[model samples]
Target: MDITQLVYFIKIVECDFNLTLAAEKVHITQSALSQVVSNFENGEGILLFTRKNGRLNELTPAGHVLYRYALEIVQKHQEMLKAIKNEANKLVGSVRIGIPPTLLRSYFIPFLPEFISHHKNIGIEIIEQSANELKALLLDNALDIAVLVQPAALNKNQFEEYSIRLGEYAAYMSIHHDLAELDKIDWSDLKGYPVGTFQKSLTSYHIVLKKLKHAFPKAKIQFTSTSWEYLLETTKDSNKIVIMPIMPKKSAKQNYFLQKKFKESLSFDIGLYRPLKSFYNPAEIILHGALIDFFNSGIMK
Candidate 1:
């Protein structure tokens, strides 16, 4: 039954079957409340209250069952209305977000505390995925938003994106490596050393690999890994160079692992992605605002 009928049903029981008292408690006329009870009993094909001299008396077995369920429905309906009212006043909901593992520490870690404090009602669900996987999730609507390295090319017809920041490919090497002393190194300079990088499943890995191979066809890439730790470890001890996105200084404290800027940098367009939409919920609007504020704070600089 609808909420109004459920409420009236509960009120009648609470008023001890007094039609006048129940109707007055519920701000309705006595005859109107009596007719509501009659219509409900007729609709369900069950006698509710026993009649004594044409007056409502004790409840029947069917009436007792309806009373129990009616109480529950009325209570839950009140809660639902309260929740909707709260949502109208403030952001209140959950948002599924996808982020690259590498960017979590650099980008989100610095700003999450303050953002979370400001929007306590908003629940955040974080998913870690590669850039390619994140893009797929956005397209499928499995994720509400994704913080990923922007694709080299985007189809505006399918997706909407905003660039929050930019990154670049850098060669990370051990301090003992001869090239570590250089101010800038070119792709040709990496020929003397083996390179370690992420696997082909990552869009960033694929983009940089294509450029590397185009410049130096004979260049040897000795290692490929999906784990960031494996690539970082390889570059921390030997002359092997790891080609990857430049990590924020706060994220990389290993002085032994030196970073050499690329002479001709392959820039990474990093930003937020969402399915193209004209409207967003209050929670999504707050999340977008947090991201913009974090990026513009110049903490990354």
Candidate 2:
């Protein structure tokens, strides 16, 4: 009936109807939470949850309907409060951002100094994890924004996305490697070579692994790492072919590695992603705009 009850209801559902867990999350006693839900059901004369053997089983049809509306109402309520607070406080809040390890230094960190300089009042917290991990944190509402290498099969409805750059996977090898002379490397060309690439936590790893397996069923994946430096070092002196996003031209030249695109391009878009329903405070809005502008200006190129 009230916003507090609605919040409790949403948390209960999100916790899979576990009253104990929901109570813990909301910092209340289990018996008190149970009594609140019982009172709400009694007052409204509605059976919101189905119970079996004195344990919550699932939401009733009416509960499902209420859950949907509750989410919208709570989000709007929070947004209203944030808007008022931001107006009174004036552009001061922390923004929690997630970036994958592989793209941290190469893609995002270069723009931070300037962004921080411009918004000295805003505090920025950076979380470095793999792309898969970042996605999980975003879904759990732990990250305000994430820099993701947008996969081909991304669920567009879950997040609002702004494409920053378009790129594709490429093969890297020592300059003296046999395939280094070729402008583009075919999947079949790596038949006998040991392969190295990003760890399974990255979307790129799965993309490249699938293509490599399809093209050569017996291909050997000898090394898997989250560190690009490790991959580069592993490939520099050995016969291992590293498949990853195309590195900066300067890095490739200095590292003495040849970059060759895949004959069949494995492409992706690097973008900023935020939960579609989440409210963005002033700090987050400014940070989002700054990131888009930074990428659009082509300073990283």
Best by TM-score: 1
C-alpha local distance difference test of each model: 0.81, 0.84
Error of 2 at 260 (Å): 1.8
TM-score of each: 0.64, 0.64
Instruction: Report the C-alpha lDDT of model 2 over 2-47, residue by residue, as the tens digit.
Output: 8888999999999999999999999999999999989989998998
Cα shift from native, residue 194, model 1 (Å): 1.6
**Could you give candidate 1's per-residue lDDT for residues 203-254 as a string of tens digits?**
6567777778878886656788877677888876687889887777776668
Q: Give the TM-score (vs. native) of candidate 1.
A: 0.64
Worst 10-residue stretch by lDDT in candidate 2? 247-256
Supply candidate 1's per-residue lDDT for 20: 93
Question: Would you give me the overall lDDT of model 1?
Answer: 0.81
lDDT comparing candidate 2 with the true structure? 0.84
Candidate 2 lDDT score at position 237: 65
